[model samples]
Target: MNDKPAAPAFDRHMLEALVCPVTHATLSYDAERQELISHAAGLAFPIRAGIPIMLVDEARQIKADD
Candidate 1:
């Protein structure tokens, strides 16, 4: 049985305020991956169940490398 609460759906206003933690840049939501992608920084922050994974640790690094 799924024990997680359904994540709250974000509206346009909230999406506008969403930013990359690393670069503090704008993010584009990818409904497929349920992630907030920062193209400039090349990072894709995951969203679980519906809630966004805003934490750096939880985020998946994109084209950018260490």
Candidate 2:
């Protein structure tokens, strides 16, 4: 394998427009996990490569207690 890291897919402005389906809140992209987290909603949405996996089933639920 080349072992070279891939470049960041989305920038801050792009992420700013992304919203949580469950809560309709803003999303914070986690490049490491490739997941989008909604802190207020406590949900984690997965991002495949540079694209977001916006499906509900693909998303992770976050509890307020977490």
Candidate 3:
């Protein structure tokens, strides 16, 4: 029997409703990285267990090269 907890499922509908807290711009989902990318804010908000951490303090600054 599997003992590990199931990972939370990401909802596409919810993703469409989310915006960047800093820029109030639309966000793009990076499914491979499990992050929400904000081009206007130049930050990437991480999604842990399918729950997006939208706080800027918790987000990673995006590089030009990225």
Candidate 4:
């Protein structure tokens, strides 16, 4: 049996509608990292099991160098 979990598939339609919870700005999808990046908020929201966790508390703070 395959023990590895399948990668979450992001829906384009949903991505188009998602925005930053903090800044309320448009979000950009990072397929490689499976995250939704909010340049305005400087945070990256994680996508788990094909579901986007848009909570500000759950987001990762992004550094300027990153």
Highest-TM-score candidate: 3
The list of candidate 4 runs beyond 4 A from truth reads: 3-5
Per-residue accuracy of model 3 over 1-66 as CA lDDT, tens digit each: 879997797787887789999999999998889999999889999999989999999999998567
Clashes of each: 0, 0, 0, 0
Q: Put the candidates in TM-score order, highest first.
A: 3, 4, 1, 2
For candidate 4, the 10 contiguous residues with the lowest summed lDDT are 6-15
Least accurate 10 contiguous residues by lDDT in model 3: 7-16
Which stretches of model 1 miss by more than 4 angstroms?
1-12, 64-66
Highest lDDT scorer: 3
In model 2, where do residues sit more than 4 Å from their true spots?
A: 1-8, 63-66
- Model 2: lDDT of residue 58: 84
3 against 4, candidate with superior TM-score: 3
Candidate 3 deviant stretches above 4 angstroms = 1-3
lDDT of each: 0.78, 0.78, 0.90, 0.87
- Give TM-scores for every candidate, taking all chains together and pairing residue i with residue i: 0.70, 0.70, 0.86, 0.84
Model 3 error, position 55 (Å): 0.4
Tell me the tens digit of each residue's lDDT in model 2 across 1-66: 789897558555778687888778888877778788888777788877567877788878877764
TM-score of 4: 0.84
